[model samples]
Target: MSLQHFSHQHPLVFIASHGHEIEKVNCSACGELVSGSSFGCVECGFYLHKQCVEAPAEMNHPFHRNHNLNLFTRNPYLAGTIICDFSRKTCENFVYHYSCNLDFHIKCALFSHSIAEKKNVEFQDISRIDPSINTGNVTEELKKAECFACRKPLLDSIYFSPNCGFYLHAKCVDLPAEINHLFHQEHPLFLQFNSQRLSCKICQKPQGPEFVYCCSPCKFALHIQCATIPTKINQPFHRKHPLILQSVDECLPCQICQETTNLNDFVYFCSICKFVLHIRCVSSPLIIEDKLHHEHSFTLFPRQVLYCDACGTLGNYVPYICSTCGIFVHKNCISVPRVIKFYRHQHRIPHTYFLDQNESEPWECRFCLEEVNTEHGSYFCSKCNYIVHVKCATKNSRWYYEVDSTETEEATDSDEPVDLREIHPHNLILSGDIRDFKQCHGCLLPIDTSYCYCSQCDFFLHKACAALRAKKHIWFHYCQKLLKLTSGCIFQCCMCKYFTSGFAYTCDKCKERFCLRCSLLSDMPKCEGHEHRLRRFTGESKELCRGCGTSVHAFICKPCNFNLDWNCITLPLKTQHSFDVHLLNSLITLMITIIQEVIIVIFVKRKGIPNIGFIIV
Candidate 1:
């Protein structure tokens, strides 16, 4: 018999299987197990459930009603993978395919209709939103039930079907299909079932086959709970200001815990100062385990009562204390390296929780050059008498932990040159020749051979200087270690009793001068501008340098009638005078020419020797 259908040519016959004789098979219409009465054809092996065969051949879904959808038993594409456009799930059985290339599962279409109709029949007794939703008495058996919509635990007031024992969360039933969020402003996010297990970009949570707010074109997904997170929040830890949620494009570490914020996760930012905190770091555990510090668990305390055992400074906030061993440490000090190879020490130093007071000699921290309290935490070396305070060892950008101690301490040149990112633009070569006339650009100390140098930039750094962590907590500088430029002036070098017009590293907290010559550079050759070999002449003399006619203090030059001062000898041959528009050359000739013109005037003025120390060079 002819019947109105989408795919079949002839009408399917109503067949049934006797309880003892007929075989069982799956119905093609709904892909469900069929044993009893079924509408099917034996010739083509095509089958359908009696109820599925009665389903309409055309449907107008509430979600997409631009055009009527034709029911297709098999994928119209015939071979390509067909996914329901609405739920983004693989289409298993019947699909309502429209001419506009849209497809949806039969179940999803019915759910859409139920949602559009605002079905509240089952939830009439249980309010959708109530303040006492979680306060109600719930049986243990019913507490295990999950919402049918989101598949989450039915903790909130939910609608329950007594007959089938089906449950649905009140919030899940009322969730909107589409929404616009501030984080993803480019497109409207739609409620979709994520089967690919893509991670949410906002909270960095993995998205399972659950309802998530997603943007199809951008491929961005956020969990429903994560999407509803407030834009601003005030936690007890930071009550002074309300933290605002913001997008961070860079890897910025949280100021409190020193843990970096994920680029994908939202950050609670404070615009007033350079303060940033990670969302996860806000509610840090009150008690946690630290294997490196103590054998027992640590309990976080509200106030700082004493100096930190790790850094030896009075903490600014709460600190962790081990009740069993009486070890006090800063929260930021938990991840300190267990073993480290410092530039000043030859042997590998390991972290020590307590020092032996019975030792013959008192323990001294080599970093600060001060007596270390044996009761506190510090890095120690038993082979050698090396000890360093926790803060002194791991100060911002100080010690490098990127390489293993064995490999970093190895005296081998097989390793490739490394590019010191923000420190220098060129690659630095490792050199261990303190005998060479070179200085480190970082510390301005002589390269004793254990140093890194860049020939192109004329830069040098002690191996320790090269391995310096980008951030550091220097004892001399009050603020953190920050690189700064030096104006071309006579700024006295802090370490060496010399003057430099070159760059000096400084910080915001202190003006402690540190020139590269004193920190990194060592043995050096004669000055380039002067003709004679200059020496470090610190002698009591009323002599003058004829080069600029200035008093000679300490200089590097061969003995001549005209002694050249250190600054005059090191002057660049070609210099641009502020008053002059062009670069001037032949400085020696210019001085001689000026002196020649003065010599004629001196003769006429009747000069008797004129202290004759000054002469044209």
Candidate 2:
């Protein structure tokens, strides 16, 4: 469409407005009324959005590949709905377009429609339009137009759908809150910010506001990211199993949906169903019971008992309670109605119902170097007592397969699906606390999650974050503890190998902020050969340190031109460095060799190297 047809579309006429009345469908940028003729504003003037001119009667986007895109005639920014994107198996929401079933952000659609057609591009439906509106009389109730989001009046920036008598404040037409993005099922994603993540409930694609739904309650939840799946399912992936809408009351921790499920936020998922969960919700069973392996019934437990003759994981999976002697054994141990086909050994081990611990020689674990007591266990053959840990026996978690029964969408009152995605690796706890520093005590990520801080020495991390991946990481020699960073102490960054002057992970003893990863230099591959393992700083305290005077999130060690972003503390240890010359992580032994040469040379020379000083051998 081009501006050539606008001469016949609308004629300038006087409009009455006691305050502000609906005027001609116009391009606020240009005096010409927008009636679907022309490119942007009259060639020399800014034009009204194309979507504004030809308001859709109905629309279905390609991205929203599966849903029925219904065109709504009313404002959608009125309320919200709990959304679940069946694709990612997680959701994030708290806002919606309005009461209308418009799925796309109003602003997003406005812009998309406006730019969809290039300037002067001839459209097949081109024709001179009769664009005229009668602002004959203003009703006392209808005259008061207001924005539903910010609750402001229709000011300068506004969008009106003339075909349906709908209106919205331009600014309020699009708005989304920050979320972890727990509303998808297939693809992995996080917050897109204002980049426009609004999509459809059925098609798993981007859409406009006309194809959405909104709730009447708080108006905080949104339906754009929802799956619109009906409460029942029978798909190719799960024909025999039944899938239903998650009930809010049944908030059991999902084994497959949560990465930890340690907190109480678990909701609607099926143990029997083969549906997978979000990365944040992936978890395996710690305890279970079955009647197949053991002659008697047995329950699985997560604690260690006497060594088992078969799998030796210190009674960690789950143990079965005996009706007699009060003895507990792993279901995979003792009794055998048992004929099992071994994958690794490739030999069928016939059922041997021997539960006697008094056997002459107890079996030893083949994988782990550990002794096994024959009491509550299984033994292979006399010659080869190849032992597998009970935990390792069922590594696939279970012996079952099903079709991926994706649900046919229905209007559901479900909350955002559980966040089965990856954890915020940076949200770990800071263990070694000190003053004026704000960094993770353990991983050295950042101090965002609820954390512990030291008034004397600022350190922090939420209790749960501190415990994350703690088993794999122990403290380094330089820093006594990997305390969370807090306010009150000065810090020097461990990364960028610079002395941070502001808030960071600092040592109380040395009064310096050296990050946990940098302090663990010896534990790393290339850092082993350095003259000294990067321990907590041993520098003496001095007042007026530049790094100590800044805010909590930044780690500034000015003397060395070093600054650490407090968020770096939780970074993985095997991460590759910037100055290492290689794009990949250095092998442990090779890394150690490089460190040795660099630090040794620096130690002997008594001065920094020409260009390699920061390359801390």
Candidate 3:
């Protein structure tokens, strides 16, 4: 029958059936090899598949819901390159396009529509195909093969065809052709192969050459599992509000784990309560039964709390509580070690909830030289009366090590009398007597007790300072080279920035020096004035010290707006001033008070004191 189509100018003839002889001729509409039933114009050598010829001019495609896709005989883009969203193959002739720059081949659009409508008969139940029907070798070969769609091993149920060599996971075959995900709301994600091998935004894992839902323009991709996460979920801990999946750039803390979400791009957020949760923490257990941490199981306390009794840190929304002990704690703090040995102390310290206040003054933390709160948990040693804040003691793994409770406690190296003749040239005798005016040659700090005295040379070294190794690595130094212990030469300490002739750790390569006191400073220094740990200030701008009101390089607690200069940080707890008969308490406070009084006196004298001068009492 002679037929005339809008795509061609001349009349065409319909061929009911054609063999391989006519397969070489391409279809004018679909641009695929034309065979079987088709219409052809002999003079123009133009042909169209019967199905392609019958395709509608414009249709509502399931893949793109916002706009109707219109059939196009030529490339619609200025670049003249159109690739089908579904098949990911170049569409040379006929294509379906929407206003949003989405394109699809005629066959691909029809195939996806059939699949979405659940009318594709080619999708068969994988269980119906029995591997036993074939030989063991063929069954083994099939087992070793991976699904063509996801590129994952086909261990689970999959759609397979032996003749076509097509293998696809059942879930991959059912994936949506296009989806509007919360992670990339600017553009719709299309199911495509990971040809560029981009990393998944959700999991932060590199993607293999597998099927991934991707936004090509933004280069955003997500795995099938990550992309299919529910938009809203009702967690047991946060039963009042359903958390919605959102992409946020701001630094927010996760309610479940109480950790900053800066490293994560996507989080589950509750708009009503402003509660945020890490995607991985959505499945946190409601009850924890760790016997090593405690004898009783801890139940989830799903409410805002002021503080955690275990670590004494500010609490968040989701903390676990022990009903038996009446203690609320963070999930991560449940496994805090019972006993630990700090590098700064000689004796093993045990965790204690409360310290006895029988002493005249508040116990001080030896690590940071800050007053330790007797109420909160802390690491205490009964033998040495040494105490440290729980957060400070366990801040760095290199500074402390967990000790087995059952293991025998060995005498510390400081306790054993060491012959330092090799390094000091004098025989040093260990003494525990309080020397009134003796100073440690190693640290240059006054030796109160437990020091090695050399009466022959009038030199002394604190027991702890005497054990200083010849070479060591200071954690805070930018240059990681080992520092050598050197004496006799005066140099400015890189950490405290003070010039002293005392023993110092010198790095020849970096030309940096650190005094004995500053070399022992931990990475995170806890201050009594602030609840948070103090970090070394690295900004170029001047920061005023909270203690003395002077701008100097200092340790800063950013959250608390606290800055402490090196002089204030290393101030002795007790100092003997020539003006006072008794020992003065808190040298930092005393020095600042004296300085303020002197400033007031200088200002009065500068303004010219009146003739009626006060008489001395």
- Please name the candidate that would achieve the greatest TM-score relative to the true structure: 3
TM-score of each: 0.44, 0.22, 0.50
Candidate 1: TM-score? 0.44
**lDDT by residue (tens digit), candidate 1, 248-308:** 7667656556566766457887666434667666677898886654457877775435566
Error of 1 at 339 (Å): 6.6
Task: Give the per-residue Cα lDDT of candidate 1 at 272.
Answer: 64
Give the candidate order by descending TM-score.
3, 1, 2
Ranking by lDDT: 3, 1, 2
lDDT tens digits, residue span 1-617, model 2: 24322322443232222122323545442223545332343334344444333534344432233333443323334454323221111112111122233344333333333322322122223332221342443344335654332223433344343223233443333332222223433342211211133543223345322323322121222332342334354433234555443432333323222122323222333447424222222222444444444434443333434444344434222244555445655444443324433333322333232542345765544322245544444434343445443333334423111112233322211223212112232233334433222344344343444565444443444454333332111223222233334333223354445422223344455554544355333321222222321212212332232233433333223334333332343334443343455423235335544654554565546644244443221
**Alpha-carbon shift of residue 128 in model 3 (angstroms):** 11
Better of 1 and 2 by TM-score: 1
Clashes of each: 35, 133, 0
| Full-model lDDT for every candidate | 0.59, 0.35, 0.71
